[model samples]
Target chain A: MGITSRTENQGRTIFINVTERFDFNQHAVFRKLLNDAKDGCEFVVDLTAAEYMDSSALGLLLLLRKKAGNNRVELRYVKPSAIEKVVSASNFSRLFDCKAVSPL
Target chain B: MSDQCNTDGSLNLVFKPVSRRLALVVDDEPINCVIMQSILEKMGFETAIAHDGYEAIEAFELLAPDFVFMDVIMPHMDGREAARCIKSMTSGRFTPIVFLTALDDPEEVHACIEAGGDDYLSKPVDPRLLRTRIYSLERIRSLYQKLSRQHDELLFKIAEEQENEALANRVFLHAVSAHNEPISGLDSYSRPASCFSGDLVLSCRLGQGGIRVMLGDFTGHGLAAAIGALPTSELFHAMTRQGRSIPELLTELNHKLCRILPDDRFMAAVLIDIDPVKGEFCYWSGGMPPFVYKSKDQLIYHSSSGLPLGILENYDFVSEVGSGRLTDIERILLMSDGLLDVRNQEGATFSSCGFKDLMDSWASNDGFFSALDERLDQHCQNRLPDDDVTLVSIDLEKALAVLNVSSDQSADLSPEPEGWEWALASGGGYLLDHSEVITALTDTKYLQDWPAEQAERLQTLFGELYNNAIEHGLFGLDSSLKSTPDGFHLYYEKRQALFDDPPPGQIRIQMTFLPRQQGGCLRLVVQDPGKGYDLTRLSELEQHDDPSRFWGRGMQLVRSLADNLIIHPPGNRVEAELRW
Candidate 1:
């Protein structure tokens, strides 16, 4: 997967777009992007263009959520498809503000 | 090179030759040949003499002697060449050749050995040396022969064992790999990692016009693990066609597997029963991978809440049942753990998130299975996976068309029965497992004379109607409680607590089997005392776009089964008519 980022809302909200399959292969790029994330900054992961994700990717999200734990930076998910079933089943929705996917 | 012998200038050696030793002597000189033959005979061996190198090979082939005494300097081919030929022809046979040498030079002695002789016997042949060489070589030949015979026996045994294994494989395949009736909507692809697979999908038509599909994966994939599939599928098809409930089926499966499977083995499975006319599905899952039910719009899922089948005793196992109403273009997908465990070159398993995301992509497309298969194919590439990967999809809308609900009539469309009237009233002031009450109706004498198919359909209708009366009419329990995980448990517990008294409304149920002039009719009425239900709610649910809601599932099911569903004022008193 390819990761691209943009800052909006006066640099407080950073939206990261993950394209194609999101898996362990994208760990390097995801880690590089995470380094720029600072406290009090809101991060929105846009998976609208993503097609697939695995538990390893969930593990990566877990890693970021833990890292953002001290920052109080709000981690929001945008346009997640029904793919959020795994996340919901695992109770990750309690940690992140998951936007309901558009009905098919 | 001869260190074991005495190293004196004059050879001093003691030798003892065993009787029955056979020897061949090759010499160019006739007199030498005679003398060699006489010495061999004196040593108790049967002698065969060859005059020259050419004669030696010919005589050796005829004699097959155990030992050879060769003159080093001989005619046509010479002793060295003849010894080389004989050694090469003997293959594994240990025929020791000792060269007869008159020369004292060490180089001449070395040449004889390099040409293939085992040792040098100096000539003007010393009888003592001849005896020493012959006796030692004879002992080795005896041991080699015994070893060769034992090797042959082992080869025969291995062949027999392999034959038995092949026969078993054939028998196992014949037993489990037959599907006579193909269900149109149910499609599956199972690629075994080896000669046999631990994954299986079995389908059967239920007596009540429902279709039962069971997808199972055993503990491991291969020949040994595949043995479990035989018993599991046999029980699934046999019991499902007999109109057994999901829980009852699960109990039998668990009982069989518990006795057969090893402690380390268990089957993770999902069993679904779908009624085509009513478009309602009830499922029970145990330890299988998380599966999803997808419609045109939203996705539905229930937690996998029970232990895998075959791991527990029949009485100890508790399987939670989940119900859903199917919408147009509705489908359910069940996958074995092997599908999720598929790893790429980097050794990362296709995680739960990946499966969900992939399913999401298929939401807008009808080729849900194709996309999944292609993506998995690409992910695996040319390398075969180490586990059996299986994916099964049930096409509900398509199955509805294939599963004809109207086919329950007698094949002859026989004249309708003009039987005697009868009635049975159950659940007067006590709460019961209402489904069990209908199940018991199958054994009634009235239905016993009816065609088995008609009797089963009538029983199914009773089950759906009885359940509705108990939950909504008698107890006034809201259907929405079924949305949560423990909602059914709570609803049943509440029903249990109310044993001391009846529901708020007056409760009455009457089942009448009446004979009409032209046909037969079964009239069933269940009236519960309570404020009447809102008719608007039933109408709204009837036309709602999303069928996944918990409300009005049983009513719609009843409306589909009965010829007439009439609700009186307050919607508390309901009447249903079934005409045959």
Candidate 2:
């Protein structure tokens, strides 16, 4: 539905929380958050509340990687759900650190 | 008071007439009509006068005045009624109406507005107020005219763009499907979310009595995603016609797409090659949904195990191909992910379980695709899918039957009375650089109108014979080096080294076509100058039973396809005869 972000550890790390659907509709906010982040800062994208994701959302994540550099971005709380197949099918695990965790 | 300045020393209003404008004045009293006419004439308007509401309508229709002034009290028809009639007749043109009222009653003014009065003059009719009101109304009217014109232009442009898009879609569809061979037992359905579909389905009859099919889904739908289909189909049909293997075709396709598409865009594809004669199935799946194979008692799934095409350069696609025997499998089904992602009115998807359930419910494979399509329609309630959807069903039994009939018919061509002969000789250095010489040599003008199957068989026969003469005779390389799978690559590496610095030798190929009573005969002779092998070695290769061995299969294949074969002196020369 929307995107929210907060900085912690003196701005060295940023946690981006995506709520509800993660799709092309969230492109603007996601791009702004990525643009505003400081250089060399690590990013942790939280997908715990996302119920669905589409191909364009995957494209956005690729764009984020292109801007943040390799290994500087990590995806946390990717539930072992239907959307996981889409992510794994594209071999996204080879490009990013994807941690699949159980839903609370 | 002075005309240029009032008592307060403010500048007086100067009226400048851009063009001559007409004004209509209506009143029951003569004094009132004269007063209005004097004010309008001073403002540079040519005036027309009407005595009552009846005359006012008549004068309006005749003059088509730019502006009108109507008294509140009149005979025959009241000014309010006349104002309504005049406004209706204007027909989208802006004509400002000013009502002249003697009484200062707000009720009368409200009634005047209800009858389409633009503005009103109170009592004696102030000239200054009328001048300012007229100026503002003219500005508003011009603005409305500009907006209406723009609205019409926008509508026209949209229609033109749609027409162009439809024409382009027709051309694109033709390019994608024109080369498709209508082979039986192959059924497919594709629907796009927009004017253009990114899903591509291509099937071509293989030159060697089989069929090759590829179903690919690009990154997204519509025109941007469909652009890659043009080159993909062209390459596919050309390569399939040349009798290339599945792995080789996939590798070349991957290289072509990677060079053209963007970084994030790629195609998820499944390629299947069926050889009914050998009862073999070879498939390669990359980043697509699992394909299903339904047998007599069991259903098998083959999931993708490699990245999609165009994602990485230098992809080793040969290792990704999986091969199996067509033992009990009756039919195979392939689909894009869009089929599983289709959502119903309740926002629930038709997942893999639904697909499997439908397959189980079917009693036989005869109506499986129709049943699947019906189920999909029932689940989604005729809703257009969010992405492009493609489904392909291939019946193995039907395909085998068709293959058998076609192979038998290839030999049924009527006898021809024409005869021709051709010969070519090339040095080792020239042959190494132009390894495709066999294709050129087989594709002569004399064979242009022959059946494709016959022409392709001749090409295969020529390829094997030429390779044997050059590699075994001229280069003196041992066929035993290709006994193991890894040794196959090593053998090629040594052959490539020899090609770099080839020995001094020449290969001469001569072909003669002779007329016959039933069909024609092609006699091909290939000669080379090198140390010939033992005559006993040829007999051992003819009876080699291990079909898996890659080294001696070339001579065995030649023997099977040729009607007559003979090795000339020293085994450095071979002749093959084929009847069609």
Return the interface RMSD of model 1: 9.8
| Per-model CA lDDT versus the true structure | 0.68, 0.76
Residue range with the least summed lDDT across 10 consecutive positions in model 2 chain B: B403-412
Interface RMSD (Cα, Å) for model 2: 2.1
Model 2 misplacement above 4 A:
A4-16, A26-43, B1-168, B352-357, B360-363, B366-382, B404-580
What residue runs in model 1 are displaced by over 4 Å at the alpha carbon?
A1-104, B1-169, B219-227, B262-264, B292-294, B297-304, B314-318, B328-330, B339-386, B404-580
Q: Per-residue lDDT for B28-56 in model 1, tens only?
A: 88898899887777656678888788899
lDDT: worst 10-residue window of model 1 chain B: B402-411
The sequence of per-residue lDDT tens digits that candidate 2 reaches over residues B7-69 is: 223212333354338889899899987888787777778889998888999999999998888
